[model samples]
Target: MDLKAGWDGTWQEFLQVDKTVFINELISFHSSLDWTLELEPAQRFAWETEYDLMKSMLGHVVRESNTNPETCWVAFEQELIGEGGKRAADVNLVLPTGDLFVVEFKHKTEASEHEILRANSDLQTMLRYHSESIGLVGHGYLVLTKPGAKEFKHSGVVCEIADKGQAPLLTNQLITSLRQTGSYDVLRWSKGEFYRQPSILHGTAQVFFDTKIPTLKTSASENIEEARDALLKLYQHAKAKLKRYVVVVHGRPGAGKTLLGISTVASVARNDSVKQSEPIFLSGNAPLVQVLQHTLDFYGKRKGKDVLGRAIDGRVMIEDLHIFKKHIKSSFGSRKETFVVFDEAQRAWDKASPRDSQSPSELMLFCNWLSSQSFGVLVLLVGDGQAIHRNEMQLEQMLADLDNSVRAQNGNIVAIMPSLHAKNMRLIKPIKRDVFNLKTPIRQSYTEHLDKWIEAVLSNNSALARDVALSIESDYPLRVTQSKSLAERYSVELQNTLHEGNRKPDAFRSGWLMSSHGGQFIEEVQKDKFKPGKRIGPWYVEPPSSDNSCCRFDAACTEFSCQGLELSLALFNWGSDLLFRDGQLVLAEDNRHRRQYDHYTEGSYRVLLSRGRSGLVIKCDDSETFEYLKNCGMRVV
Candidate 1:
C-alpha cells in the first residue's frame, strides 16, 4: 500500500480497537459469564492492576460478583444528548428491581483521577435517565485483574478478575428482573474529568463543517461574479509576457491586502497546475507575521489538501524575508515560475544611505534580478504609503521605480492601478472627525468632545494641563513632546521606574512609527529606549508613563526632534526667539544653530498648512510669531 493508504489503514485500526474495547466492557458487565474468564487477557490484566491500586488507596467494600448475584444486570451502550445534541456512554444496565443504571466503564490505567471524576459528572445523561422515570443509577465500574488485600476509596466500584466468574449469572438475573419490571432508572457517577467548555468545542467542530467555512465573495467591480473571474482575467492579460512586474494595490488596513496576495498566488497556481506551492508571504514585523501564519493555517486546515493543493502545494510558507532570504533561496531555488509575494513591502526594505551601504537591500536586489532575467514574476505591493516604516525607504523607492515602469509599459497607469481605500471605509468604524474623502467623513458622537480636546491641547490651557495629569482619561489630550535626547533619558527613567517597583512596560499598542530621516533617534526607539506614543506632524513622541511622570528632556538643548510624516505643532524653548512669515510654518532651515522661516507665498508653505488635522499648536517664546500662526488658522499653544 502507498504511504497515505497505510496511514489510513492504521487510523481505521485504531478506531476499531477503541470501539471494541468499549463494546467488550459493556457486554461483559451484562453477561452471565464469569467476569474474570469473560474478559480478554489484556482487560483481565488491567482489572487486576486497578483492583490492587484501589485496595491500597481506599480500603472500601469489595465483593465478588458470584457472591452478590442480586447486583447483576444486562448492560447496553446508550446515547446521550450533548451540546451538539449527541454523545454516547459505554453501558446502560437494567436491574431486576426495575432500576435502570447508566454505567460508564473506564479503563482506569489510561485516565487520571481528575479525568475519571469529570467523566462521571455527565449531568445531561443523568438528567435524561431520570426524566425517563426509570430506576436510574449512575456508576463508574473499575474492572481489575485480581482483588487486592489493601483498599481505596474512589467515585465508583472496583471489580477484580476473581469476581468476573460471577458476571454472567448476575447479569442474567438482572436482565430477567428488568424484563419483568420493564422500567429502570439509576445514574452511575465517576470523578475527576474535564471537558473543554461547550462553546469552544462547538466552535471548533463548526470550523470543519461545510456551511461554516467562509467563501471569498466577488469584488465590487463590474462584470465580476466571483474572485476567480477577476483572477482569470488578470492571468490572461499577464500570462503572454515573461517579464518582471510589480502590481501596486493601495488600500487602508483590513482592505484585503493579505487576502488579495493569497488569491493572486492561488490564481497563478491554478493556471500553472502547480500542486503544492503556496505564496511566500514576507513581512518585517514578527508579530504581524505570526498573525498571518495563524490565519493562513486556519484557512488551510478548513480547505484541506484537495482544495489547498489546487491553490498551491500543501505548504503556505510565511517568513520574515529580511532574515530568511538565504534559506528561501536554498530551498526554492531561482526558478522563474516560483512566485514571491512581499507583504508589508514598505517595511521590508532598508532605508540607510546607498553610499553607506552595510548590507544589500534584498527587495531592490530581487526586483533587479527579476527584471534582468525577464521572468514572469508577479510581485504585489500591498500597503498604504501612510503606513510605511521609517526604516524602509529603499523599498518605497523601488516601488516608485516600479510605478514609473508600469506607467511606461501600460500607457495609462490610472486604468491599470486600482485603489480600494473607499471600499475599506465601510468595514471599520473610524475615530471622530477622521475624513476619508470629504463627503464620507466619519460622523461620531465624540466629535464635539474630540474637537474641544484638540482645542485644549493646542491652546496649552489649564485644561491641557489637567488632561495631561490624567493620562488614561477618556478625553485624554494628545501630547507630542519632541526632544533629541528623549531616547536616552526615557530609558534611564524607565529603569528607575522598575527600580521603584513598577512592572515592565506593556501598555504600548502596536502601530507604525514614522520619521523623515534615518538616524540615532529611530535606532534608539527601535532598541526600546525610545517608543512611539502618538503622532503630531513630523514628530512621533512617546507618551508619558503615567500622570505622575513626564517626558525627560535636556534643558540646555535648543534643537528638538519632531515627528516625521507631517508637521502640526512647532515648539520654541523658553527665552528663545523664533520668526515665522505670515501663513508659513517656522522650521530650522538645517540641523544648525541658525533658524529661518519661509513665507506662505512659497509653495512649501502649502504642504505645511495641510499637515494639521484640525489646527496647529505653536509654542513660541515671543507672542508675535504665535499670533501670526493663530491668524493663519493655527491654534497657538
Candidate 2:
C-alpha cells in the first residue's frame, strides 16, 4: 500500500528529517495479529466493558513476533511505578528482534514535563523487562501519538532516560495490555502540501507535487525569503550567461546574509535547477564555520545521512575559505563546484607571495580559469565596515584583482555589489544593487536606525549620532556603566529574559565581548577564553548549564574571535585600544595596535557595538571614556 503524500519523499530526502519511519511497520504489525476471542464468561465481562474489540487485537499484535505467543498475550500485567503513582503506557511494542518502541497515546494537545518523564520511565521499565527476557541491550523510542503542539521530547533534554548500553531503570516489566493516547508525529511530518490518508471506502492517493524544502532560517523573516529569491535569480542569470561572476551580498551585521547564502544553496541542492554542481559554502570565520558544519552534520545524523561526511558529489560541503583555497590550488585541473559561498569575504587574507597566488586574488583567478572549462559564480557574503584585519582585502581590491585576472585571460567578468558600496566604486548600478543587498534591520527589535547611529558615532559626528540614538534608544537600549560587575548583571538579566521566551533555551545565546588588547593580563587566571589554543566552538554551541557556554559570561571573546557572531544581549568590556580622544575616535597611546590604520580600529568597535540583538551594556573602566561615551548619546546604567 502506497500511503505516502506528496512531501513524504521530500521529508525522507532532506538531510535534517526526523527518524519516524514506522507507519508501514505498524500496518504490517496489525496484519500479523489474529482476532480470535475464546474468552470465558468472567473474562468477557471485564474485557467487553470498555475494550471488547481491543482484547483480541491487542493480544494478537503483541504476541505475533513471539515464538511462545501465549507469553505475549497477557493484559494489564505490568505497571510503571512513578513518584506520584503507578502508570502504564497505552501501547508498548516489545520485540526481542524489533526495536523497543513504546507508543504512549496522549489525547491531550500538550505533553507536560512530568508526563514526558512518566512516559520515559514506563518505556524504560517495559524495555528492561522485555529486553532482559529477549537478552538484547538497545535504545528505543517513546512515540507519543497526539496531534499536539507541546513537545518536551524534541527539546534534546530527556529528563529520566538511561544511557545506551546500560541496563534500563525499571519498576515492573511483566507483559501488559496496551492503551492509546496519540500525537501523530508521523502524520504531521508527512502532511506537507497534501494529505495522505487511507479511506475506508477508497484506497490511498499517490499523485502530487514534491514538498518544497524551505530556506534555512536563523530566524523567521520574510525579508530573508525575498533576499533568497533574488540571490537564486542572480545565480540563475550567471548560470545562463556561463560567465565568471563576483557578486557581493552585503548587509549590516545580523541582516541575514549568511542565512540567505545557505538557504540559496539548500534551494539549489534540492532542485538542481540553479546549480551545475553541489555548491560549496566557505567561510574565513573559524567559529562560524565550525558552528555551521557541526550543526548541519549533527542534524544530518538524525536522518542517517552523512550530509558532510564526504562533502563531495551530492553532499553539502562547508569548509574554511583558506582550506578551500588549498583544494583549488592542489586540484588544478580537477572539476570543482561552480557555485561557491565565501562568508566574511572582505577578511580574505592578502597575497602571501610576490605573485599574489595565495589570496582571494587566486579565487578570482580560479574563476577566470573556470570560465574556460566550466562557468563559476563566487557569491561573497560581506558586511558594511566589517574589515578589521590589516591584511584583509576590501571591495575595491577584490574588484581590481577580479578585473586584472579576467583581463589577463581576456575573459568576461560580471561583478555585482550592494548599492551601499557604490559610493566607493563607480561600477555598482542602482538597478543591479537591490537584487544583491539585504537592508532589513534584524539585530534587535525596533532597531531600524541602530546602524545609522553606530555609523554616525564612528564617523565622529556627535550631533548626528545623538539625534540618531534618540530614535532607537527606547527600543534597542545601549547602556554604559563604569562598573564591570554591573554590566555583567545587566547582560545576564537580558540573557535570562530572552532565554525564558524559548522552550529550548539553548538555542538563544548571550555573551561578553572584549577587545584583544590587554586580554593577556586576564588570561593568566586560566578561565580565559582569549588564551592561545582555546577554541570557541564549545563556547558558542554549548548550553548555558555547561561551563563552556558563552552565556556563563566567564570567558569573554575579543572582536576578532566574534566578528560574525551575534548575541541575545551583549556585555562588552571596553578595552583601552579604541576610545575617544580630543573629540575623535582613536586607539589609546599604549595600545599594542595603536600604530594600525584608523579605520581598522573603528571597524572593530562597529562589530562589537552591533553584536547584541536585544540590547548592549558596555563596561567602560576608564572614567573619562565612560563619561565621553555617556555624553555621546549612550544611555547610562
What would the per-residue lDDT of candidate 1 be over residues 101-191, giving only the tens digit for each residue?
A: 3433344334333223323433323433233322244444433223341223443433222243233322343344434433222222121
The top-ranked prediction according to TM-score is 2
Q: Count the backbone clashes (under 3 Å) in each candidate.
A: 68, 10
lDDT of the structure predicted as candidate 2: 0.51
Off by over 4 Å in 2: 1-227, 230-244, 273-276, 298-316, 349-360, 412-433, 444-448, 459-464, 498-503, 518-534, 581-584, 591-595
RMSD of each: 21.9, 17.5
Candidate models: Cα lDDT each = 0.33, 0.51
Worst 10-residue lDDT window for candidate 2 reads: 200-209
- Candidate 2, residue 532: lDDT: 66
RMSD of 2: 17.5
